[model samples]
Target: MMRQFTNQQDLVHAGISYYTTCCLNLKSLYDNRIELKTMFISKEWEDNMWSKNEAGRRFYNLVVSNEFWDGVLYAINSFEPVVDVLRRMGCGRSSMGNIYGELANVKREIAFRFENKEEHYLPVWYHIDCIKDEHMKTPLHLAGYYLNPLFYYQNGNEIEKTEIFRDALLECAHKMYPDQSVQERIVHQLKLYRTASQSFGRARATLMNFDPVSWWELHGSTAKELSTMALRILRLTCGSLAYEQSWIEMVHKKKPSLVQCNKFEESTFVMVNRRIQEKAQMKDRSCTCIPSQ
Candidate 1:
């Protein structure tokens, strides 16, 4: 029946059971709405015994319903941006530098999709805000947001002036540094960073197009203490999938050890370093291949 209405014999399948796949499936169904409605009313459907059954009738009703289509459209519009965030979190590249900014922007993107109508967008915003408060209200998130070169330089001095960011930075600094003298040095170096001193004040530094971790490597040396903190924060991955993958790979190659765990720890560190080196090499190749305008 579907084949009579459309060139393809079946609905599009995303092939996986993830939430993102569900969204994709819904989008596909919506894209095939015309084909589906035609299939429901065609003689082939009426003559088919299965289509006469109560279950088949219910499915046919759903396919032709205006309310159902409206809901599907709304769900796609709302959840698409969220799927984008999930993809970034799952990708091999470090999302830590941008995840914080992405989360903040996702809310705006959803609202804009709905034309900023409060009646259409406020409920979605409430749920997104709840998720942010419950799971993402961490010092690490704030520190990453503040350290990202794109965000940091774009917001000017306002990032440092923000109270929540200020508190999060202080918390992260003290927690990571431990020593009071080191904390003081970090604070002092932060001022130099804010004022755009030395290498940080360079014309290229002001461009705000560079990768946060790479920018730190190039210009952050002048602010040694703050640079150390920025590099550590910006290099983090947003999800635990990579860690779990590393553990699975480790177990496949080596026997479990309860007594000699230091050896396992060393192996994990080596694997992590190898992954970082591989990503860096890929980034360098990608950069070299881009033609200069």
Candidate 2:
């Protein structure tokens, strides 16, 4: 929703490279990948470097470098409600908390330990050779992918939230893994996620009351203001009455205890952070990764 600059090329390239290192067994190689020591291979190779699909894969470094801190805070604020929804559904806040906590860990992995270190950290594009592709010679990062899927699913428009979520997930794969194989591996896991969701059915409904406009109302000023923000919510409600009623139902059903049905599972990115452990094998280098004219 909010954008800052226009350094897309660096983003795609960095994203692909990051994912390649994470998804593959090339941890050894990543340990040496310094920074903009290498160049992107091809434009077409960008797709698979980020995720199983394209949700947040298109961002560039120019935007990030100029407004990185603002973007991070904004993303965290937006994700707050999504996590709240999940919490109402019985999944604890601790679950989401643990995930963000790791962002500091990743940041520490790269630069020195700042006062408040982060886990969801990334450097610039480097070492094209370490990548095994659908994302060769591309530049992008995983932070966008991570937040995109979270937003798309929690409060996106009329499309299959899964599709949007999948795109973001794939981009994350490219940014966090070592090869396309990691993306491939996640495709199968996605099916499992679908099956588990389906299996829950009404039980799942109890956990999440379908509300399109509630997020709008809380995050937006008024229904009229929200309409100005995104029509997708209007479409999601199929009108406005449906969304309001759904919100009421969800609030009414908010339970403090776990109503577990087969467990809300997430495979791939949550664990197995070994991808980050194996960064690009290069010398400690410094460059904005934003390509100069």
Candidate 3:
């Protein structure tokens, strides 16, 4: 409602002032964007290789748009300028501009500063509150507590993110720590102290947002090319499927000592073929692999 003022120049002036305040920290949105753009360009992030800074520039424009500046101008003329400026944004309680700035601000805060172990993990703990599913959340919790990069292990370059995931999960288990012998046993064997120790010095744990569980593990493996062993053993975990000894079975039975995933992705073709065969036979379109001319 505050945008109707003809003399909104004062609001713009005041807004310019507020944005410049940057928490008394050494960052301003304008300055940070420029620096980050330089960094991204130097690293040649995939997004940047394709018109990178243009998007960031547009965001800067939004924050400093004339309409926005005018609203800010008008706001300064009033006693409660913050309220008026918010109204002009017309976003009710949810301003995209606010979110954009907040995310940018946070990214700047934790971007490269993981030097202090406890301090580094403080931000991630806030993010973990956002997770809701246990079947998956369990792995994530383990990884966070493990605090090590979920990507690297003692394994060779042939490593997959799963082993890292297992280690994190093992670490998380110790942290939550049910009093049961089973929980204690798993934690003891996983070497939690050692893993968390390594993570303190490396940047890997921070990179994956400290979670080893990824969407790749979420969807059952797609069959393409993998070892014959993978083809024989990949098992899909039905989300609704619940069991008592499930973890034990998965870890001891289906888990190939050296293989790296839920295994179903590597070996799901036979099941798909069987279903296709059944459906085709139901119709006259039964299976046929005739070469096309």
Q: List residue ranges in candidate 2 displaced over 4 A.
A: 1-165, 192-203, 206-293
Candidate order (TM-score): 1, 2, 3
Kindly list the per-residue Cα lDDT of model 3 for residues 127-201, writing each as its tens digit: 533422333334443243222223233221332344754554544444445545656555453343334333223
Give the TM-scores of the predictions, in the order they appear.
0.76, 0.19, 0.19
Most lDDT-accurate candidate: 1
Which residues of candidate 1, in runs, are more than 4 Å off?
A: 15-17, 156-161, 195-198, 203-208, 240-293
Ranking by lDDT: 1, 3, 2
Candidate 1: tens digits of C-alpha lDDT, residues 199-264:
877834445566788888888877888988999988987852432364446654666545266776
Clashing pairs in 1: none
Question: How far out, in Å, is residue 1 in model 1?
Answer: 2.3
Question: What is candidate 2's lDDT per residue for 36-63, written digit by digit as tens?
Answer: 1122122432443542345433333422
User: What is every candidate's alpha-carbon RMSD to the true fold?
Assistant: 6.8, 25.0, 23.1
- Each prediction's Cα lDDT score? 0.74, 0.30, 0.33
User: Compared to the true structure, candidate 1 yields what TM-score?
Assistant: 0.76
CA displacement after TM-score superposition, residue 53 of candidate 3 (Å): 39
* Residue 190, model 3, lDDT: 38
- Output the worst ten-in-a-row residue range by lDDT, candidate 1: 284-293
